[model samples]
Target chain A: MFFRRTRSIPEEYLQNIGAHDDLLRALFVMTQFDGRTVLDGVDLAIRRGEIFVILGPSGCGKTTLLHHMAGMLPPTMGSIQIDGKDIYGIPPAELDELRTHMGFSFQHGALLNSMSVLDNICLPLREATQLPEMLIRDIGRIKLDMVGLIHAQDLEPSDLSGGMRKRAAIARAIAMDPDLVFFDEPSAGLDPITAAEIDNLILKLKTVFGITMVVVTHDIPSAFTIADHMILLLDGQQLAKGSPEEILSSKDPRVVNFIGRTMPLADPAKVDILNYVAGVDSRLPEPRGANS
Target chain B: MSPSATESVAILMPSRFDRETVPALLQEVRRGIHEGQHRICLDLREVESFDSAGMALVVGALRAAREAGLQIEIQGVQDSVYDFFSLVSVERLLEEPQALPRPGFIEGLGGLALPLAEGSQKGAILIGRSMWGWVLSPFRGQKLRLGKIAEEIFQAGNGAMFIVALIGFLLGLILAMQAWVQLKIFGADIFVADMVAVGVTREIGPLMTGVLVAARSGSSIAARLGTMVINEEVDALEQMGIHPNRYLVAPKVLGLAMATPCLTLVFCTMAILGGWLFGVTTVGLDAMAYIEQTHQALRTADILAAVIKGATFGALIAAVACSLGLGVRGGPEGVGRATTRAVVTSIFLIILVDAFFVLFVKLGA
Candidate 1:
């Protein structure tokens, strides 16, 4: 007969974050994949009672940063502090305890297709609490109402529309009334109207429940509307960090170009068209006049 | 702002005082109380919503104030906050708590036993449902596809025939050759035919066929279904409200159960032929005489026993494979591990079941 043993972390190795005013702090965090650095010595502090958005172009390690902060992936170096405790230094049991106070929503609404929407929302409560089934159901219903999915609670995840699935996933994320909620591309595939509605919901949750939020997205409009603080990442490095307006006004060409979606161009009248047709070397013989 | 004039200090609260900010807010409140302000009013007009942590903060503040010979009053509590306070029974925080009794060994045992019992009950229900589907399929107008059963039968039985035949023939030849040497000293070399016939029909035939099937078909079934699970096809089926066992496992079970006995018969015939060939070439026994002796040695009960063992082993192998497949987790490596586990577990159980059948046959005799 075989039995699994749980490994425990020693107390002396755990870092204390009690002096920090920030709710979550990352100190010189780094992540490497196959000896290639994906997140290079990132230092950030997420203040309490704020919507902190991590904005970047595709493949800029935004999702990797979120995963490290959420404790789903450990940083290669340095530490992440959540609620004054080092996240990576904790034992698995203690880490699970910490995670109960945090919720993470995936980019594609990773709801279990085997369960109904109501069950999906109620799963956390059911697993973590000894609450009666009826009370759990009522809580699930309330979450559904909060997400405007009350009528669709009985439907399977597959039966839901894309927006509905995202809403339902958010509902499930907030089911336990977590202190912090992390969303990955919450509005990636939604229409503008639905995306705005999600943004409104994020703001409402922050104000009404006082839930600190960390959102990773490339949706500039949604980020500006919902974020209290924003960080712009370029190629795995922080390009800028400020309020949305400050980010937009940044003198850094990279920041400005990212936010405004502007691409630098040479003057069309600078004789570039013929040079491009003939190739970069102006000395190269031009193809015989096309008509000739 | 001066507590000396009014004797009551008013502390303005932030718009949000939930878990993240509660510690800082508590520290500030403690600082105010330490400054000799006997009366404090927490102004909450600016605050919109608060959770359990916020409630705890308020309770903590009130306790701190009382300990300092001060009185604290909460003002401008919103309706939403008040609703949560009432729902969670915030008043209980003010009451003194009782010490709880420690759990003993029996209690811990019972705690473990309860979940195990529940899991066993659920497993029983799953088995019952799958068995019902298997038994009722023919009467239900063939809800299970015939092509699928045929495919499984071909895969499990036909695909395994060559190896099973080879092993069966070799086993018979080895058994007869060994028995011939022992019996020839007593001038009873012909008894080798009887020994091979009885042993092959009653035990070796079914056992070899089962081991081969478990290694071949069992691993294939497990790997196939485990891959399906990794791809979320099983989840997709459940999302469509379809019972996976009824659709996936029953056909495999029913097909293997039907095929095993037939394969066992084929295996036995091959084994008897190999024994006859060995007896004629090595022991100088007439082929017809050896055949007659072999036919005389196999009783009807022996053949029935082989068929029973073959069918039982088939069902056991299929059921175990499907269970392991459905329980797969993690990723591609998980599917590989599950396939290995299914084959190992099926063969182990097959041997154990064979022992039980052997005992039953001995008692009947």
Candidate 2:
């Protein structure tokens, strides 16, 4: 459950840490699937009222980390403290109370296809509050307006375009004016314009509401645009944690390769296509003839 | 106690602190806090009933008081209210209470009973709504898809006709042949017709048809709906605010209900024909005399009972199938399990229902 800090904490990141108290703190958080570890000894401190984006390649446990942070999945080791309360250690009722102030936007809209856009937005409000239909409808309308989905309120999730569905899901996520919001791959599978629009919406929501946002994505452009602070994960390990500028300038080879989109070079002497294909030894063999 | 300069007067809590009373009570308590009361005490001795809304109200007031740099205390708390607060872990606001003991075997049984009761309740609602869907369709401008129902009827009943006829014919022949050997010893071979007609019409015809349909159509229905559930189409329907029972189940129930009795009639007629064939060819009895004996043994009530049983079994099979299908989870494996469960449950219910009908008939007689 011990994580070795890979690099010195960036001065700006340290300043950001000093600026606001941590709303979410993960201490030695680890997750295992079957026998293999998915997230290994991860430590993170997400400050309040800031956009914290988790950047990772596929299978790097970005979504898993997000789920752990959101209390949807329990870590194999360590603890996640949300607002100084141990998320998993609390009783169900207390956990529900904590969750009431939080919202999660899934990667795929996950909007109930049977419900109209309006009802999808209204669902959480209706479930969590005893407010009358009229008030609930007004609130739903406001959220739809925020997401620019007022014209499509009467249509089903299936009837809307993919970007519209994502917006609708975002509308539903923010419907309760939650203190914390988590978005999983908001810009994934979206066109660049739609993706930028989603990124802008994320920024606007954070700016206007002053709510903390945690976005998990591999979309590098989207991450750079929206993140005030970011964590780069590789093989379930934190490779770097800092602002986008610091991350871009990181001397770490992995960070440089990832940010620069550089492919790892392979030496001809170390080539073993057959072994690699068989998954027997994926690592490059030692140089056999190096100018000898 | 009277209000003093340093000691605040405790507000008397209501006996019933539920949704109806809590709103007004919360407002009054908030007003009291706003009126320069730094120390507030709530008298909870009178509380006979308390719900989550009540707890929320009290918690909200406490939070507001704390935010305003005031203090609040609870006094004379009733045991029941105290227990509820402890159960909900709200005792963190006060002092932590001892953890309650885990439930034992009997409690586990009671826990199991809840879901069973809930499932039965949901089944009843499904049945009621499906029935109403048929009854009110015309007025509601919702057309019952006769084409879909017809397809189901054909698949469940008409396609089943060949097997029903084959089994019915074989049963009649076997019954008459078995009875002929004994009757021949006493020179009463004419009674073979009587035995076969009564046995097939009263029991075997309806029972065999039900079991066949249960295996054939019931499993199919469960598999179809279970796949739909896996595909999230059922969820889609639910999201659209349409009841799966009314949309998916009602047509099948009505179609099978109509078709079953007709199949039962065909089964009984074929069985009698088979007996006549056996009596004339093998027993050396007069064909006309055998037909007359079979006719004499057959009662109008017996045919009516068989038809009623057929209709009831049909409805039960469809309902059981639909319920199991709707409850399916996981994936293809779940659909397979649901299909197996539907067949087994339908057959069990068919036998159980048939036995009840038999008991009623006997009592009436």
Writing each residue's lDDT as its tens digit, candidate 2 over B279-336 gives 9998888999998988898889888888888888888778878888888865566688
Give the fraction of reference interface contacts each candidate recovers: 0.02, 0.00
How many angstroms is residue B26 displaced in model 1 relative to the true structure, after the best TM-score fit?
29
lDDT of 1 by residue, A1-292 (tens): 0211124333454344224678998766677889888887677788888899999999999999999899898877767888777788778788888899899988988998777888999999889865545446656766677778877877778678889989999988888888889999999989978987898888878867778999999987678678888888888888998776566556786776675552223423223322332345344222111111
Q: Which pairs of residues collide in candidate 2?
A: A114-B239, A114-B240, A115-B239
Question: What range of 10 consecutive residues in model 1 chain B has the weakest lDDT sum?
Answer: B88-97
lDDT of each: 0.78, 0.78
Say which candidate scores most in TM-score: 1
**Residue B153 in candidate 1, Cα distance off native in Å:** 13
- Residue range A117-231, candidate 2, lDDT tens digits: 8899999878988755544665565567667777787776767787998999998888777889999999899997888788888887776567799999998767867888899
TM-score of chain A of each: 0.83, 0.83
Compared with the true structure, model 2 gives a TM-score of: 0.48
* CAPRI quality level assigned to candidate 1 from its DockQ score: incorrect
Worst 10 residues of 1 chain A by lDDT: A283-292
